[model samples]
Target: MSASYAIADCLTMLGRNLKRLRRYPSLTVMLLAVPIVFLLLFVYVFGETLGAGLGDAGRAGYLRYVLPGIVLMTVASGAQGTAIAVATDLTQGIIARFRTMAIFRPAILTGHVVGAVLQTMLIVVAVVAVAVLIGFRSGASVWEWLAATGLVALTAFAMTWLSVAMGLVSKTVEGASNLPLPLVFLPFLGSGFVPTGSMPTALRWFAEYQPFTPIMETLRGLLLGTAIGHHGAGAVAWCLALSALGYAWARRSFNRERS
Candidate 1:
């Protein structure tokens, strides 16, 4: 009964929000468009400027090198939308109104998170389709490909929860929306584009230890059908640890919002 009640409340909230999309259809299009533009900008405009090393290695190799960065970008984009939507709700006293209702109080926010997750899944699909259309195919088996995509999706889910926490804590929409930038930057310093050994010592140290590299390493390995070179265990651990951390923080924020 409790689970059903929570789900229904969330779905109802999701339905209402979906309907609101028709008010300005461009809003949803913009969410999908920004990332596609980035893909083009990086893969074409700056592709040569970034250097020949990544490209000389073949299109597949280039995609392999930059895949993690793109994955991070997609999730970051989704999370930003999640935070903004949540902030909008809080700003307009929609949350306060819901508090007065008899339905599950927490379900309102949970609903938003669920809706964000669904949106993120859609973003992932669109990204992969665009990627494949651009010759970003993985030579791995079908199952391996699914595993790789699933790993990235898992990271996105954890990130969406973290954004929910940001939405609950930030004082303004700008604060809420842009908070994902730091998280998104993590992959850049890691082994996402270049090997950690090639980086300066300080950066190398950070890259070797930062959660992004391992996640990227893991995803790359899965996508390429290779084993994560050295930090495979650490990468898997970071995902679990980060998810737990994000969940704990989000739950605290959720509780505090009610208080």
Candidate 2:
């Protein structure tokens, strides 16, 4: 297909995916609920105790500290929904039908990735709004806000691509849903809820080296004026690497299915 034709195909598929999301809003709702629930739970239940660890910051301080992690967790939460959607399409004979059509084959997967990213960002916005209402304050300027938004979107795009690959490989919808569970909880294993410093030595080292930690740290720096250090580079590198790897895997899997 010509570049322009492929672009059109991708847009059509994206529109179709979005309409599906609207028709059955449950998936989006479920994706949004998990991170928001965790946000409220950790901030309300453990905020006082955990905030004390940040010196004199307390609950309000903890809210600011933890919001980045919650936001990243929200991005991760979208993986299951994307995987389920992809698996449903693949198993329902849609992929086979599309294969016979004249449209660009990869556009179908692109549609899923784009749609998931959009849903994820909307969930992020709602979560951030709730955080703001509950006293999660940030002194980030307009530029900082823009940068943070871009970073979150990039992270979501990367995770969505990986989820697409997982879905492509899944033999069942249930398997697809469960396969991305690691992505969901990875933030917790990093600096999501608590500082890496507070973790046990081995856990702390792992936390510090994980992808989410640098991403969260970069977010904290942008939003809360904390030091970003080397995290900005690390976050960009990790997102790019994951995106490339996921795209290659998903495309190879889809092509193999075609043959």
Candidate 3:
């Protein structure tokens, strides 16, 4: 297809997936609920104790510190739904029907990726709104806000693509759902809940170097005025690398299934 035609086809497929999302609002609500619950639980229940560890900054300080990580977690949680949706489509023979149609082939997958990213973005926004209501504050400038937004978008895109690959590789919908569970919890292993410095040596090292840590740190710097250091570079590199891997894996698996 020509460039414009391909873009149009992708948008058409995206619209179809979005319509499905609209028709079943329950799925979106369920997917959104997990992060919202976590946000509330952590900010209200755990915030006091956790913030104490950060010194006189207290619960309010912990809220600001953790909000960025929570936002990223929201994206990760939404990605699970993407994997389930893709697996469902595959198991239900929807993909097979698409393969038989004359529409652009790549659009089939593009549609899913785009829809998942958008859904995750909305969930992130809702979670952030809740965080603000509960006293999450940021002194980030306009440029900082824009950069943070870009990083979040990049993270969502990368995670959505990774979920798509997981879904394509899974034998069933349940397996797909289970496969992305690690993504949801990765933030905990990083600097999300508490400082990595407080962990054991090995765990601390791992947490410091993990993909999520750098992303979380970058978000913290952008939103909460924390120092960026090398985290900005690290986040960009991880996102690009993961996105490339996900694209290759998803495409290879998709083509294999079609054949």
Better of 1 and 2 by lDDT: 2
Give the per-residue lDDT digits (tens) of candidate 3, residues 1-259.
Answer: 6888889989999999999999989889988888888878887898888988898678899889888778888888888999999999999999999899878999999999999999888888888888889888889999999999899999999998999999999999999999999998999999988999999999999999999999999999999887999999999999999999999999999999998
In order of appearance, the predictions have TM-scores of: 0.88, 0.98, 0.98
lDDT to native, each model: 0.74, 0.93, 0.91
Residue-level lDDT tens digits of model 1 in 1-259 = 4889877887888776666665756656777887777676667765554546654665445655676667767777778887888888888888888888877776776677667777777876787688778877676888777776777767777777888888888888888878877875676788866678878999899998988787787777777777777756776677678778777897898678878
Per-residue lDDT of candidate 2, residues 217-249 (tens digit): 999999998889999999999999999999999
Error of 3 at 64 (Å): 0.2
* lDDT score of residue 28 within candidate 2: 87
Model 2 clash pairs are none
* Rank order (by TM-score, best first): 2, 3, 1
lDDT, candidate 2, equals: 0.93
Q: How many clashes show up per model?
A: 0, 0, 0
**Stretches > 4 Å off in candidate 1:** 20-27, 46-51, 58-60, 229-232
Candidate achieving the largest TM-score: 2
